[model samples]
Target: MQHSVQLTYDQNHSLSWGKFVGSVLFAFFGAQIISGLFIGLPFMIYTAGLSDKKTIALYSSLGNTGGTLLQLLILLLFIFKYEPIKKLLLPVLNFQALQKVRTYIYLFLFFGLSIAIHIFIISKLFPHATQEQDLALNLENLNQYKILLILGSAIFVPIFEELIFRGIILQFFQQRFPFWIAAIGSSFIFGIAHIYSLGVMVGAFMMGMFMAVLCKKTNSIIPAMLFHMMNNTLAFLS
Candidate 1:
């Protein structure tokens, strides 16, 4: 079972400046190191050194696999040790609230249209370099492992990111800044953290905005996480 602190204006059971800053810094750095090691550093090492087909393929495969596992481990640790979470990790809400067909439709449209636009823009702008790195491996090389990769990308990563973003960052920002400001700022940070490609960064920013909206409207992270998961699932499948 999950435990949460109920906060109200009257009680205002918030952290002191020192504690708040420390907590935010810890989470931010932890996220950065974990995300960077998994996707960033490995990608850099591979692209910077390996030019051969076999070497590139091997490096890419290892990086993606290892990074995903590391990310998953971090997420599990955060969830399991929720008691130590000094700050709100996610916008608290009931799961049943997100069971509406309308919610599903909204999320489907948002994810589908946004990703489609990103793809279209990428194709138009840089058709030659699209998936240049990934193409070295091809679908043939990723047969059995594809399933695990898909699960990590579509299901696991989205949930993990949303929980970190909409749940933790959003709540913290909302306490200090205007709602829109907090949402946009959090989304911007999210986009920059990926630092993959320009197109991917823009898409990530848009995703952050979408998740923020869900969190703001519902006052909970459940809808955002669900929408994020569904979005990743579609990306993985397609």
Candidate 2:
């Protein structure tokens, strides 16, 4: 009877984990698909010769931002409504007192680390990759669509990404597995999601790992989100 009870409990736990994982995956992918469609709508309209390329790109970027924000709103609703997800994410959302000096130190450290890894990835690891070149070209060409780029990259992307990866996925994995396993696994997924080139992937992985560590240390996703925003802002400026 005891053995049977234990087995039943384990089965229930596994089912719960499976359900949570499924919900998260659905939210993530569904948002992306929906956002892609929304973005494509503007392009299609532009192709109908109603708007210029820059106007279409700007509208597409706005659509992308709206989709991302909608995804976050849906995920936030889920997080609040679901007991399991709430329990997992409560620590991340809860306010905590932080030392000003220490906070600045950590911010600087993470920012510097992100820059160093990006430089190393571009210069040594994937020297032939045009990741930096592509970034520069994009920046140079952002005369009219600068607002769209800033809003999409510096604001929406960081918040949504941190909530999804650090707040939900990493915390869920940490519950089921060891810390390092969870961190690396989530970081790998994060890297793959941003896979434009080898250098970009490596940089993203490193940044993800760093953000994971920050989330773990602070027991809050706020810091990670801020760090991500800072990183994105730097990239935008550069």
Candidate 3:
């Protein structure tokens, strides 16, 4: 009877594992769709008729912002639709790893350190050439429409990206894999998605892992969101 009971438990665990993996894939694919749309639409507009670099940039920024919003919407929907799975996610979301005040300081320090590393990497690699063009310049050219770019960059991108990567994808991994595996694996995927440069990739991947860990440590998505927001704000300023 004990052996039979063990077999039943194992079967149920296996089923749960499959479901978790499926959910993670769904979230990943959804983010990709939104992300692609964001990057592609502006290029389409530029190819079709828009001759102005500024106009293209503004449009691209809008796409980036909108894509993020869609990602957040997906996260909410997934959480609502899969309450049982979300329960499994809660522990990862509410990690008790950093209960000390020093941890908060360390978190921000890490954020700053990562940014410095990216800047240095960009300097070494591109040397006199800017890798990713400044979206702000493009938006500025649009004059009236620039508000859209600002809002999208300063708010939308951070919120949406964090929710998709940290809230959904990381948690999805955590439910099935060990903590380190989930964090690193998701971070690697997140880093690769950016396609900026080697330095940028390393910086982004590191940030991704940190954000994932933060989400787990805090047991709340807000911390990661805030961190991402600050990072984006800095990017906009730079």
Give the TM-score of each candidate.
Answer: 0.67, 0.82, 0.69
Task: Please list all clashing residue pairs in model 3, or write none if there are none.
Answer: 93-219, 94-219
What digit string (tens of lDDT, one per residue) describes model 3 on residues 26-62? 7667655765676646556664687767666666656
Deviation (Å) of 87 in candidate 1: 5.4
Q: Least accurate stretch of 10 residues (summed lDDT) in model 1?
A: 128-137
**Steric clashes per prediction:** 1, 0, 2
The parts of candidate 2 lying over 4 Å away from their true place are 1-4, 7-15, 37-43, 46-48, 97-100, 128-143
How would the candidate models be sorted by lDDT, starting from the highest?
2, 1, 3
| Best lDDT among the predictions, by candidate number | 2
Candidate 1 residue-wise lDDT, 88-190, digit = tens: 6533644765767766666677666767766777457655433542354354444336565666565666766776677667776787789999999889988
Error of 1 at 94 (Å): 3.5
- Tell me the whole-model lDDT of each prediction, alpha carbons only: 0.65, 0.73, 0.65
- Against the true structure, candidate 2 has what lDDT? 0.73
Error of 2 at 201 (Å): 1.2
As for candidate 1, its clashing pairs are 90-167
